[model samples]
Target: MSLANHLEELQRKHGDIERQIDIALSHPSIDDLEIVDLKRRKLAIKDEIEKLKASPTTH
Candidate 1:
């Protein structure tokens, strides 16, 4: 896939993670560790998106 497509997909995943985190926060039954993991995954995806945006390549 092209870089733009990849970035778009990453952004979608990040948004989905955000929604999951929100849902997890709303429910007391959700485990703390699960929320933490979701946050970590979200952060990682954000970092990746930033990295891709900063890169010079168009691919």
Candidate 2:
């Protein structure tokens, strides 16, 4: 896949994770660890996006 396409996918994943976190927060029975894991995954995706954006690319 192209770098642009990959980046777009990562962004989509980040957004999805954010939504998951929101939904998870709404339920009192949800495990805190699960939420934390989701947040970490989101942050990791965000970091990857930033790294890709920071580097000069044709995309």
Candidate 3:
């Protein structure tokens, strides 16, 4: 796949994770560990997106 396409997919995944975190937060019996894991994954995806955006090919 092209670099742009890969980056888009990663961004979509990051958005999905954000929604998941929101839903988890709305729950009455939310699991702290689960939310933490989701947040961590979201951050990792964000970092990867930034890295890809910085690549010469992406520009």
Candidate 4:
């Protein structure tokens, strides 16, 4: 797959993770660890997207 496609997928995954975080927060038993992990994943994906945007593309 192209790098742009990969970045798009990562962006979608980040959106899903954000939603999951919101849902987790609403629950009475908030999984703090899970929330933190998801946030970390989101940040990682964001960083990846940024890198993809900055990098030059062939096509």
Candidate 4 lDDT over 7-43, as tens digits, reads 7899899999999999998996987998899899989
lDDT of 3 by residue, 1-59 (tens): 98889999999999999999999999969899999999999999999999999988776
Taking all chains together, the TM-score of candidate 4 against the true structure is: 0.87
Residue-by-residue lDDT tens digits, candidate 2, 1-59: 99999999999999999999999999999999999999999999999999999888944
> Which prediction has more favorable TM-score, 3 or 4?
3
TM-scores, all candidates, are 0.96, 0.94, 0.95, 0.87
Candidate 4: pairs in clash: none
Error of 3 at 44 (Å): 0.3
What overall lDDT, based on C-alpha atoms, would model 2 receive against the true structure? 0.97
Give the Å error, residue 50, model 1: 0.1
Write down the TM-score for model 2: 0.94
RMSD of each: 1.4, 1.2, 0.7, 1.7
lDDT of 3: 0.96
Against the reference, the lDDT scores of all candidates come to 0.97, 0.97, 0.96, 0.88
Model 2 Cα shift for residue 29 (angstroms) = 0.3
Candidate 2: stretches off by over 4 Å: none
